[model samples]
Target: MNKEALKKKLFTEIYDTHWLKLYLHLLKMLDDEDDAKDVVQEVFASLWNNFDAISIHTSFTSYLYSSVRNRAINYLAHKKVVISYEKAEELRDVNFSNAPDIFLIEKELAFQINSEIDNLPPKMAAIFKKSRLENKSYREIAEELDIAENTVKKQISRALHLLRQKFIHIKYYLFFL
Candidate 1:
């Protein structure tokens, strides 16, 4: 088989063998069926995108399990951030008049961010927008643009790097960085 076909076949075998087990493991750890499913899907998607560069120091099963565990941890971390942001939003709403300056700062920060994203190279900006604003997976963005997933990932990474450099002075918005 050609390299691409062989790669796809190997990926299919790995998915067929480990997907269910990974999902079940996550389900046990997370105790939420939907969240577990999402995490498993994300792990597999990441594996597919970075397949060529992946190095297995141990068994494939071990690698997959580790990926799933890390993704679940990140998922939980993001949930915590969302909850915290919601509470902060509520407090800000209660003291809207007193926090007008804070609100203005947030607006300016957002504007700066958007301007920076727009300043990225055209292809990088497009991929970054599809990945972040449209919430598309790297695989989805690659397929849609008829480019490699690695290209999509690299563009997004570069875009973020540039944005971070532009906003390095804005320490309070570290979440974006």
Candidate 2:
């Protein structure tokens, strides 16, 4: 079938019949109603654009579900980075009574932390921010991210290990004092 014809058929058959199911599936994955709806819309738009290339044997519902899952994950990851940057900025403004050198060292440490966070894989970055800066419980972070609590804990642990490696010099710098 032609592109337009397949799009119409997919839209009419898959969308009309399964949109609610798709949205609910996304909602479960995302844990946010509005985000689920938004992801579903994006999935459909992508389907329309790529209709000609899609194999008929590929399960459309599965593809839509996976698309929504990935988009929601990316959205959550972006949000975590924004929150981390904002928190870092807030920390920078705090008054420190230490000597000028000490203040400068603290500022440098904060900068290094932020840079390491920016370099993390998306889910690891989000997990680190939510658990460390936000002080969110592992259960809460897992629920929000639709991941297992063990996964949240592991990601945070891994992030901390990477940050420690990245800033190992900080410890030596302190020891020289």
Candidate 3:
């Protein structure tokens, strides 16, 4: 089969084999059927779009599972932020003061955190996400990635250091203005 044919075949095989399991796993994580279905659909859609460039460090199943898990985490985190902002807006019903400040703080914090994560070296960023975003212990991350626990620790430490510098600069910049 050619590259195009292989990509199409692989996507079909994987989607058929994994879709239900992925959906169930996401349902367990998200506790809502619609959200679970949406996340699973997104995982497959991403796989389809990036099929040519996709790389799997481990088994394809592991990669698929991790992708769904990460997507669910991001969705829940965003949902939490939305809830917080909505609550803040409700508070604005009583007082309009500082509404923009609240929004600015929310937007700034999320942007800084996401940008810093994206800016990290790939290995460091992956380790950091496994640790912080997935809430995996150092040992767990190490085992999952087949690396030393100390390496995991060091990568996470480096990530934290870089993020701290970025945040400190942001704080000073905002404070001055």
Candidate 4:
């Protein structure tokens, strides 16, 4: 087939077979329909731009999923700073409210959670932060840390177990209060 014909055929097959699934996967990750749609557009655009170098061995679905995930993570990271500032303003606005005590309790709980997380092993803590705070998948975390995906999963499990033990003790202490 001619280069044009091959490109068109590949595009048609990819879109027909995988577009909706890819979009839905991205939508779930991003929790925003519009953002998912935008990412899908970018994914296809990148494929089109690099069409000449594209290999048949590449699993288009995997490529699309990974690209969308990375894009969503970048979007969330950028929003984190903005959201933190907004949360600070909201906290300040509520500081003198009638439920000030409730707010204080919430702040204390948050502090405790942070302290528990900080006590985790460094690698485990990093994996937990990447998975929970950064919303990265195990595959992404493993790739970033240069470890196996199963290792990342196990580290997170270990972190959770430690946190649970810590919280159980905290709860016992609270009961004595």
- Give all TM-scores, in the order shown: 0.53, 0.46, 0.52, 0.43
Regions of model 2 farther than 4 Å from truth: 1-6, 93-177
- Candidate 2 lDDT, tens digit per residue, 1-177? 996787697677877887898888878877888888887888788777777677755676666667777887887898789999999877655533334477677788889889889899988998899888999999999999999999998998899899899888878977654
RMSD of each: 16.8, 17.4, 17.3, 14.6
lDDT comparing candidate 2 with the true structure? 0.82
**Top of the candidates by lDDT:** 1
For candidate 1, the C-alpha RMSD (Å) to the true structure equals 16.8
Model 3 segments more than 4 A misplaced:
96-177
Arrange candidates by TM-score, descending: 1, 3, 2, 4
Q: In TM-score terms, which candidate is top?
A: 1
Tens-digit lDDT track of model 4 for 1-177: 897998899788987887799889988888889988887888788888888886755776676777778877887887898899999989767654745575666689789999889888887888999999999999999999899999999999999888888788667754443
State which candidate, 1 or 2, has the greater lDDT.
1
Clashes of each: 0, 0, 0, 0
Superposed by TM-score, candidate 1 places the C-alpha of residue 139 at a distance from the truth, in angstroms, of: 49
lDDT tens digits, residue span 25-55, model 3: 8888899999999999999999999887888
